[model samples]
Target: MASGLFHLAVFAVDGGPWEGPVSWRKAVTFGLSFGLTLITIAWVSSFVALGDRARNVLLGVFAADCVLEVALITVQAWRRVPSHFNMETALDTTISRMLAVGGGVLIVVLVTLTVAAFRDGAPGAAPDVALSMRLAVRAGFVALCGALLSGAAMIARGVAEVQTGHQQAAYHVAGALKPAHAVTMHAILVLPALAWLLTFTRFSEARRVRVVAVVSAAYGAAAVVVIGVSAIRFATA
Candidate 1:
């Protein structure tokens, strides 16, 4: 919430210069929103799968990663420069590398959380809710992996573009993958929200579970289709 407010404050100020359609202010807004969403889902899922100590440590790491990432991106935005694939100067190069490291940490933390979920079945949720939350976290992990891989590809291509003197091409390359990445990254939130809504329905436990199962299947299929479209777009471009 603080992060989002800060981003809004920054947005209100006149940014002297920005990159492309995504200004640094807008990027920070997106980053803060994504970070908050991640934190919320992690907190909720922790109750279902992780013990206290493990939950604290994981949440701490996740929170720190989010904070650091947003800080770096926000700083770059205020400096009126590109945050990613920027190697024009030593400072820019260092910041870019740090951002990459943050991305790696995000992938590691989420993957570990997902593994923990699988290691133990859902504990705090009702039978149907447990099924939905478990599936949601697992699907969220899969989606996060897709996001990370596509982002990695984007970073690599962006770097190549810079090396080849086509700096603007960096952001454009692998752009189609953003939709797939963004869509999947929120499954943790969306599916779990759906699960929570199910709890209020008049359906019996069995019916709720069946509905969640069908919803999960459909969500996964939709995610796959998005990824497929991204792949085709990337190939054609």
Candidate 2:
């Protein structure tokens, strides 16, 4: 909400088609959407996790990372410079590097949560709920990891492109990975929601799990296909 409002404010003041790298409007839009989505998923996952201390710590880490990363991206937008793989100035390079490190931290935190989840049993919710939460976390972990890895790859490619004076190509190349990364990132919400919906159905617990397993498999496969297609397109383009 705050991000969207800030984006609108910048757009209003800077009126007139201002197409530039790291557009403030876009930065804030993504900041709010992705930030809120991540926070929400993390919060929900806490219930699925076992330990209170671990859950609290994970949420804290997630919240801090969200604020820090989005803030850096937004700052870059305000400065009218590209946020990703930008090394035009020492400061820009520092911010960009920090964001990349932040991404690494995020991946570490999520993977840790995933490991903890498997070690500790599911939450004390209903059978269906527990099952759903468990599957959601595991599946979400896989998809989110894919998203992070692809994002890291995009960053690496972008950096290489910038080095070779093909800055525009960097943007085009990185875009090819966006769809796969984005689709997988949303698995945290999609899978859980599907599970929740199944809870309302007349199916037995076993049936529901079976259905969820099939759906999860299909969903994961689709994400893989998208990733492969994106990679091929990027290479060919």
What is the lDDT of every predicted structure here? 0.71, 0.76
Query: Which portions of model 1 show Cα errors greater than 4 Å?
Result: 12-22, 121-129
RMSD in angstroms between candidate 1 and the native structure over all alpha carbons: 3.0
The TM-score of predicted model 2 comes to 0.86
Instruction: Please give the clash total of every predicted structure, in order.
Output: 0, 0
Judged by lDDT against the true structure, how good is candidate 1?
A: 0.71
- Cα displacement (angstroms), candidate 1, residue 25, comes to 4.4
TM-score on alpha carbons, each prediction: 0.85, 0.86
Report the CA-based lDDT of candidate 2 relative to the real structure. Answer: 0.76
Off by over 4 Å in 2: 12-20, 120-129
On a 0 to 1 TM-score scale, where does candidate 1 land against the true structure?
Answer: 0.85
